[model samples]
Target: MPRAQQIRSRSISASPFLKWAGGKNQLLKDILPRLPEKISVYYEPFIGGGALFFALASQRRFKKAVIGDRNPVLVDAYQTVRDDVEALIEQLGPHAAHATDAEYFYWMRALDPSSMSRVERTARLLFLNKTCFNGLFRVNRRGQFNVPFGRYKNPTVLNPDLLRACSEVLQGVDIVEGDFEALAERAGPNDTIYFDPPYVPLSATSSFTAYDRHPFGRSEHARLARAYRACLARGATALLSNSDCEETRKLYRGLWVETVAATRAINVVASKRGQVNEVLVVGRRQSAPALRQVGASGHAVTSSSSLRRSRAAG
Candidate 1:
């Protein structure tokens, strides 16, 4: 048996370990229903919290899973969780004990990740993610961890059971750190790819795409749109989630775009933490005999013809 598959453990359930911005835990209901019934390989390029990926893994929805992210720290954390959950938990225990201390939090945050080992770096990221302001993983122009202390009275920084479960789910899966465009290029026929790029700001002032040092501005979004289209052209089933705005709609025009209501909680402005509309753009290969779509209840609901009609009417 392959080394990746040899470590698989199906008895435990797994979920996202970090609190990520724009995590799709809330939108899984709408997103889950639209997935192709049969997926040979699954690709999630912008795997923020991997809410959708973990959910799909639990269902054994794909034969192979390839998940990647632009943030190296985030990617490292995933790898650490999969490869060395016990060591990560050991390192994180001290941080959890001092999570409420502002001085300790900033001290750990200010430490250079480049100077630490792989396990240390992952532990640092998990610690900051749990204790940072709003649990956001924002970086400065120089790629520095910049979010302030969250000041929560009690924060669960280490969950050994959750980490072990996540590790089991990650067995035999590809965890990469790189550009989404490059990752999307790997998808081909019978493959399903989900793109959850940094969303376009609703307004000029609401922009917060700085998940890393690189700014996901207009050009980046355009690049992503081109990638998404290219994936569809290559016979890969492509699905994308983005803000329901004129720019997003314009970019994904003529595709099967469905507006789904999502609740936003990460906004700095308290009033903006309410219901908002987001678009899910889906594209499947026309040559497929019968592309089946799974509904929220895990039942196949629609066929390729109806999906094509929806795209045509868009």
Candidate 2:
């Protein structure tokens, strides 16, 4: 059978295929309810793991969806999942078979992505992501995949069902690869834009801002803030999340801000891994109402005492 004909077409629930730093998997319950009740178009500019997008997709929440990211490799992986999933899956089998061998993991990581075919590149990325340390997509200054091998007891490098489900949900979606500022021009009235840009580092040492070769610095944060405000001015509902720090607060000043607890999963010091407060900023069109506050587990935070109580629980 032809490769295209071999691909199955069916509706199945999906989740983010890759484990990403700052992914919204844990915050979905709190974030989902805050989305606009009716969405004409959905936009997620920094669609990392796309936890929110996949969740909304499963619910059939919008007429159409547009997802973008600055990282080309990441965008390519998503495209492969959407269009060339069968080939990508076939390529992953060998990787999965040898996933436990550290030598093979290092060899795969060292290979240049440009030298590989699209499906091969996508498969390599998936393999590394699943087996790499903490499942992080960190690259070195030379644009190399440098994360060490993770000694997982049984890492799942190939998930045919989840990939097929992702492909199905992505049937009509438009995927873009570039800076998030473009959303200001692309998003308009009746649209809901979710900005999950690289968060401003709470402390200088805690920076996960090197998403790609380009570092998301303070200037990028300022530029994104402007783009976000522009989307709001153009009559779109915008939602964003970031570290609950003075810097992040300054960026979204005057916008509806909600504090929520999030577990810090990717940290060098194991002791520092725990529940931490993060801010959710909402910017809506003039007609939209203020966003309701939700705690870590998606329950409403009605009062200061309740907020304190929630923090204590975290």
Candidate 3:
């Protein structure tokens, strides 16, 4: 049997093990149906918690998958899960035992990842992710994991079955690190790329793009918008999700845009946590006319009517 068919035959089930900020799990219902009917190769450049990727993997939605993130630690975790899950599970046992110990959690977080083996580093990240504040993966300017320990009554630090399932689904998949634009450039006519980059901050103080040491500021957002248009020009369908702010709406003006409501779960102030509107932009393979209407420079030629605003439950 062909590799794709062999992969699908396994019929494995998996889900994201890490708790990522701005993860798409809540919005999967809104995002999945917008995917291309047929995907020859699936590309997800900003593979945060990989909620959508795992969902698609469960359904065997694509023949091949190329997923990446700029965060090397995140990529390493995925690689270790895919290439050495048994060892990873073994390494995680001790961390699981010490999940509730604040000293142990802080000690593990303070250790430099460069000094540890791949399995050790992956284990540390997994442990920190499960035990950290709000399950966040924030890093300092020096690239140190800085989130404080989360004293949950019971946190599942290790789940062998879930790891095994994720590993099985990731078989023959590519887990890459570095610039998202590089991965976007690899998309072709047969591929569908999903961009879930750190959202444009709703407000200056509300920015939480610090998944790593590098900041994703306005320039990076502009570059990503260009990359999205390039993917559409290459005849590859592209879907993106971001905050429903004026900047984002202006950036993807001519594309099919829809607003969906998602609950904010990670606010510092309890009173601030509530439903917020996010936009989903879809650019299909046959959207050349729309592209032309917007111009080759990707400037908005049309009005805001192209944006279809409606509130769907996240």
Model 3 misplaced regions, further than 4 Å:
1-12, 284-314
* Cα RMSD of predicted structure 3: 7.8
Report the C-alpha displacement of residue 223, candidate 2, in angstroms.
Answer: 0.8
List TM-scores for all candidates, in order: 0.89, 0.89, 0.87
Q: Whole-model Cα lDDT per candidate?
A: 0.84, 0.81, 0.83
Error (Å) of candidate 1 at residue 165 is 0.5
lDDT by residue for model 3 (1-314), tens: 24653464355468897888888888876676666545899999999889999987776679999999999999999999999888998899989999899999988988988999999999999999999888888888999999998999899999877887788888999999989999999998979999999999989899988888888999999999999989988988788899989889777766667778898878767787789999887763234213212334322233333334432322
Tell me, what's the RMSD of every candidate? 4.0, 4.8, 7.8
Off by over 4 Å in 2: 1-12, 284-314
Quote the positional error of residue 50 for candidate 1 in Å: 0.2
Largest lDDT belongs to which candidate? 1
Better of 1 and 3 by lDDT: 1
**Least lDDT summed over 10 consecutive residues: which range in candidate 2?**
305-314
